[model samples]
Target: MNKLLVITVLVALLALSAESFRVPRQAAAEEEEGTLARITDTVKSYYEQSVNTASNYLESIKGMKLEEKAKNLFEETTKAVSTYTGILQDQLYHIFYPQN
Candidate 1:
């Protein structure tokens, strides 16, 4: 009877330990998801800002001198394209070689 009781207690303890381990695992997963969400939001904001700046610059260009307007448009378009392209390339790189 004593042996049986010891075995039962051991089994119960093992079960409790196993259940306890899950909480940390779940928390870690939640933390990771939160971090990913923040990163996604930041990237989205960057893209939106870049787009807004480009649009505003183009819209305002009509009032400027022809040569100056052309130069401004070229500079703004180049900068926006480069910024977005860099973001795309980084995403592609990560997709192709995901970090473990």
Candidate 2:
């Protein structure tokens, strides 16, 4: 009778330990799901913000005249080229005409 009681207690402890292990696994599964949900939300938010930015940019440029755009682009290009050439010329002058 004492042996049977000991066996019963051991079986009960084993069963309880098995159940305790499952609780942690269930909690881990829930935590993983929560993390996934947060990641999905963040990605969706960035996607929405990107779409909004593109829409705003397109709206702002929608009414711009092609000729005006071309003129602005040309002016910017000319300034950049002039600045680059000036720098090059100065470097070349210093190299060839060192004021020693």
Candidate 3:
């Protein structure tokens, strides 16, 4: 008998408490709108940032004058050729002279 009474009271309390926590439809809709706006703004910011970075990178690369690039390339090539020629000359002299 005591267990039965306890079950009945618990069921009644659960029914009463359930209605108090219900969210109003208007409030739920407002929250959803705010979340959507925030997500859209975040995505738009990322796209703009990416586009700006790419534009800056291209501009910097374009700023490199062709004359400067060619000068740098010629200097590096000359250095490499000189080193190779020196090595070949040493090898030939050693073979012909056969120093003891």
Instruction: Name the candidate that leads on TM-score.
Output: 3
- Model 1: per-residue Cα lDDT over 1-100, one tens digit each: 8546655755554454343334453355444444445555565566567769988998777656778878999999999999999999999999999999
- The global Cα lDDT (0 to 1) of model 2 is 0.70
Per-candidate clashes, comma-separated: 0, 0, 0
The 10 consecutive residues of candidate 3 with the worst lDDT sum are 28-37
Model 2 lowest lDDT segment of ten: 17-26
Clashing pairs in 1: none
Indicate which candidate wins on lDDT.
3
TM-score per candidate, chains pooled: 0.36, 0.36, 0.40
RMSD of 1: 28.0
Write the candidate numbers in order of decreasing lDDT: 3, 2, 1
Off by over 4 Å in 2: 1-64
lDDT, candidate 3, at 2: 53
lDDT of 2 at 75: 100
Report how far off residue 96 is in candidate 2 (Å).
0.6
